[model samples]
Target: MAIPDGLDRIELTGLRGFGHHGVFDHERRDGQEFGVDVVLGLDLTAAGTTDDLAETVHYGELADSIHGVLVGPPVDLIETLALRMVDLCLTDARVQWASVTVHKPNAPITPTFTDVAVTIERSRR
Candidate 1:
């Protein structure tokens, strides 16, 4: 997807983790793998000009933070997980907005689907 409007984006895709997040008791008990995608919006001017990591969002740190949220808690919905990820992205003052998608590839559903996911976007105010 294209970056929205005037903001520069830093994207992380296919971040995998195992978590106990589901409505079913068996799901929470056994846990399952989850994939996260995050798009962070901000101005890259300073970083681009100076070529300094401090002037931009450090993606390695961001990935670790996202993983922390993924493996940290047990929420019943991917929507909630997406919100948590958005919150993490917004922790950086430079990040003006964030879009998050939480993918549940192995969700317990009949008929067998490729994936199930929830997406959320939040902007700093």
Candidate 2:
């Protein structure tokens, strides 16, 4: 999604939440921790110049919203969860584009692995 140049970026990383999301039945029954990293593209000139809270997105509120989504519903795929988080970022008119990374650190793999994550990017069209 050709994001414009000079657009400032707001990054929120390592957001953790608990949810029941997986393909396996046992995974659904036993909840696990999920990590989210978000990058938002937006113009920060107004907020920078005016120093007004209303001029930019409130990160605290955004974090709460994302947390709610993480714990809200039981979705099987991390892809869907990532998309949901991207949607949340785009809710703000100021946000032009957003990228979300949903990390499933405790995925039910037979072999020991570090993590499994799904990332998605979306823009206002």
Candidate 3:
């Protein structure tokens, strides 16, 4: 992973939530709350110096994109969904490395728990 200079982090959370996506049929049908936490590594020197969105990743746009994919279709797995979210964020100009964590709060697990989640990290090629 080639990390841009001085770009340590850009964290995005809340992102509303996703109601669908999972491997089981019931999971897809029932729909659940998916929490996403993202850490974006990039070169923020330019954006910081210039104070411009063009030089950095636009979090609002990224959130919108993630929300779209989460609710759009019947994805089979959270790994796949997380990977796609990583891909979605990397489509931008400023992102050099990205780490995505998606949490399914209302998972249909037999035992009640805080939440079920999958986390993935990827760097730009």
Q: How accurate is candidate 2 locally (lDDT)?
A: 0.90
Taking every candidate in turn, the Cα RMSD to the unseen true structure, in Å, is 1.5, 1.4, 2.4
Each model's C-alpha lDDT? 0.91, 0.90, 0.79
> What are the per-model numbers of colliding residue pairs?
0, 0, 0
Query: Which 10 consecutive positions of candidate 1 have the poorest summed lDDT?
Result: 1-10
- Residues 1-125, candidate 2: write the lDDT tens digits: 54567788888899999999988898789899999988899999999999999999899999999999898789989999998889889989999989999999999888989999998999774
Q: Which pairs of residues have clashing backbones in candidate 3? A: none
Model 3 bad stretches (over 4 Å): 1-6
Q: In model 2, which regions exceed 4 Å deviation?
A: 1-3
Q: How many clashing pairs in candidate 1?
A: 0
Give per-model TM-scores: 0.94, 0.94, 0.86
Q: For candidate 3, write residues 36-58 as lDDT tens digits.
A: 88889987788889998788888
